[model samples]
Target: MRNVSIDELDDTPRVVVAIGTDYAHGHLLARHTHRRAQLLYGATGVMQVSTHDGSWVVPPQRAVWIPAGVAHEVLMLGVSTRSLYIEPEAVDLGRQCQVIDVSPLMRHLLMEAVEAPLNYDEAGRDAVLMDLLLHELARSTHLPLHIPLPVEPRLLGLCQAFVQQPNAHQSPRQWADQLHISLRTFNRLFRQQTGLSFSQWRQQACVVLALARLATGTPVTRIALDCGYESPAAFSTMFRRILGQAPSVWLAATNS
Candidate 1:
């Protein structure tokens, strides 16, 4: 159903409910939770999803899977979303949130599903389509768009600050000194808490942050400088290394 709130139909007998909603640029959906797992697809624009654990940048044509009951917030940028809310028992997409690619077939299926009735006939063509949608979701490839947050209070504070003003040249030694810990200890603790080495996590954070600006037609050179890269070429190199496409190429795909 287009533009309908899921809360109003949360008790529908169907295992899955699909809805589409459009948002103005830079709209923020404050922290909330759902009883059903959600496949939140961005048919256009970008989405920034955050939870206690970390944040994810969902690029255009991609989606983020939010497990049931995970309190999260979304910052939508010129987004038109197609969301599937599925009963927890009906799917096993793991307990963690993930960003996943939307195949062409799955994209068309999502468009179709959102147009189906809230209580689509279980024995009809819509039922078959919903089944196919679930299958597509189960087999979808997860993307490396998540930036996990560290839990240690001191370290978490530093990490949070870095995310606000990401600098590629920021070193672990600097963070360690601020925390009054040895570099070795900081590195070990960072990896243990976030499952990513300091450098890897920093790069991921820069890319994800850059994506939000990139969506709004920000130039690569401007984003590079803002992200603390010395040159757009250097920034594009790292962006390609992490996302497998140069910033311009990715932007073209997003705009297309």
Candidate 2:
């Protein structure tokens, strides 16, 4: 795992740190929780952060707001990553966990925040800068891509299997075979329980897997192949269709 220690940060009521990397292995950070609420931004790369309730894939143009005290893991896909972590008490508007769009003002302010020198002054221009940063966060948009996972042991077991092997491409029939259920019954139950068809659920699983790999800087071609795509071009096309941009362009426009 590629790691960066964030200890010894300045003594502001909230902490802000900037992280940028270009490592490729499909895993960037581990599962951990912090006392502070965290805002995870990926200026580049697609990132996946999962909590017990759901998994979130944060695009380069967006950030994830993790409420203080929630335990979650971070997964990085291919492309470079420039992230900013903010303390929860730093901002009052975004107190809950969510994924929100990072505006240009917010992005610029974050860059400035990270570049600002640490100090202990009680009042000054620095204090004003901090307040502006908090305001920018409130103006950001919230995007919907949280993948809520089922809590049942049986369902979770299946989810774990798929996460371990994203390219499995198993059909409901195959899933039924493994679970010792009739294909028709499995299909009915899966939709009834998850509000998604077997294929839809699998696509969501695949996308999250793709997000994790992309955040780690895995090659688009290799990720596509690993995720069972026939070719990188095909994968990019699909990614653009779904994400509104080609992978490389998305990466470039999001962060730096």
The numbered model that scores best in lDDT is 1
Tens-digit lDDT string for candidate 2 (20-110): 4465737757777766566676666677788787678887667888877787887776545544456666665443458888888887766
Report the error of model 2 at residue 208, Å.
3.2
lDDT for each residue of candidate 1 in 150-242, tens digit (9 for 90 to 100): 888988998899889889999999999998899999899999999999999999999988987888788999999998899999999999999
- Find the candidate with the highest TM-score and give its number: 1
How big is the positional error of residue 246 in model 2, measured in Å on the Cα after superposition?
3.5
- TM-scores for every candidate against the unseen true structure: 0.98, 0.67
Candidate 2 residue-wise lDDT at 105: 82
